[model samples]
Target: MVRGKTEMKRIENTTSRQVTFSKRRGGLLKKAFELSVLCDAEVALIIFSSKGKLYEFSNSSINKTIERYQRSVNEMGIGQKTTSQDNLQHLKEEANYMSEKIELLEASKRRLLGDSLESYTIDELQEVENQLEQSLSKIRATKTQLFKERIRQLKEEEKILAIENAKLREKWDEMQSTQKEIVEVETELFIGLPQPRTTR
Candidate 1:
């Protein structure tokens, strides 16, 4: 049978808790060392115990690493240093470019939505009107073509219906003539027959 899972509450026994902390701390440090070795990375770790004791570990001398960190920070201008002026200039230029792009996109959107055309200069308005007129003319031409095609189809359908109606009328006339001939034959046969014996 499988064992039951444990709850997430802290361990209440001091000895057990201490042992767990020691084991986990060793494991964590070992993993950190392995990561640094495998990835060629510099690693530093600091720890404080409940007794107010301090401990530190570094892949290299602590002083050298700290000096390097300080130099990098100086170059980055983190403490009133003006070393990053070039980077600031580049960022300002990039911001200006982005602002211009945004303005262009907004203007395009406004044009697409037909907003504020009256604010444009007369020359700009004339250009826009010319484009619109061209588009409208194209649309009208397409619509006229479609309407002509539809009318042509309707005319053809009407012609077909008229032909079918003529054929039906011809058939009806033939049927009526046949019926009239049968009636005439029956009348002749009755007249030619000896007159039926007088009723007495």
Candidate 2:
């Protein structure tokens, strides 16, 4: 059976707690040394006991490792700041593009609705009219296609229904013929296991 999780709290008695802390501190140092040797990592660990006694472990110079950590953290902060600035710039450009596109679409919509045609040249007005006619033609063609598709679907459904109805009718006829045969058998007279001899 799998072992259940044990609840962990602090060791309450002073002697037990101190002993536990000393054992754990030794284990932690051993683990840190193993990690550095096995993984080729620069490891550092520092522990202070309740009596203000210091315990320390390091695979390399602890000062050098601390400096390296600080340098890495600073570089990460700088890289993040640069990335954030780039993202902000990209967002601003996208917003501008969207704004311009919206304005163009709104102006085109106004022209299509015959609301903003006062500024258009004759050629531009003719072009807009042609666009409207083309759009209307495409819409009508699409509508016609949908109606044809619907008609096809209805015909297929009707054919299936007719086939089903024919099958039902055949079953019904078979049932009626069976019932008639039963009635004819029941109506016969002199029903017995042996046949009777004819009289002279």
Which candidate has the highest lDDT of all?
2
| lDDT of each residue in 1-200, candidate 2, tens digit only | 99897459877899989988988898999999999999999898989998899999989899988897787688788874447776798699979999999999999999899996888999999999999999999999999999999999999999999999999999999999999998788555675688778999
RMSD of 2: 20.3
What is candidate 1's local distance difference test score?
0.81
In model 2, pairs of residues that clash are none
Q: Can you give the TM-score per candidate against the true fold?
A: 0.40, 0.45
Shift in Å, residue 82, candidate 2: 7.1
Q: Could you give me the TM-score of model 1 versus the true structure? A: 0.40
Query: What is the total number of backbone clashes in candidate 1?
Result: 0
RMSD of 1: 21.4
Highest-scoring model, TM-score: 2
* Deviation from native of the Cα of residue 199 in model 1, angstroms: 18
The per-prediction tally of clashing pairs is 0, 0
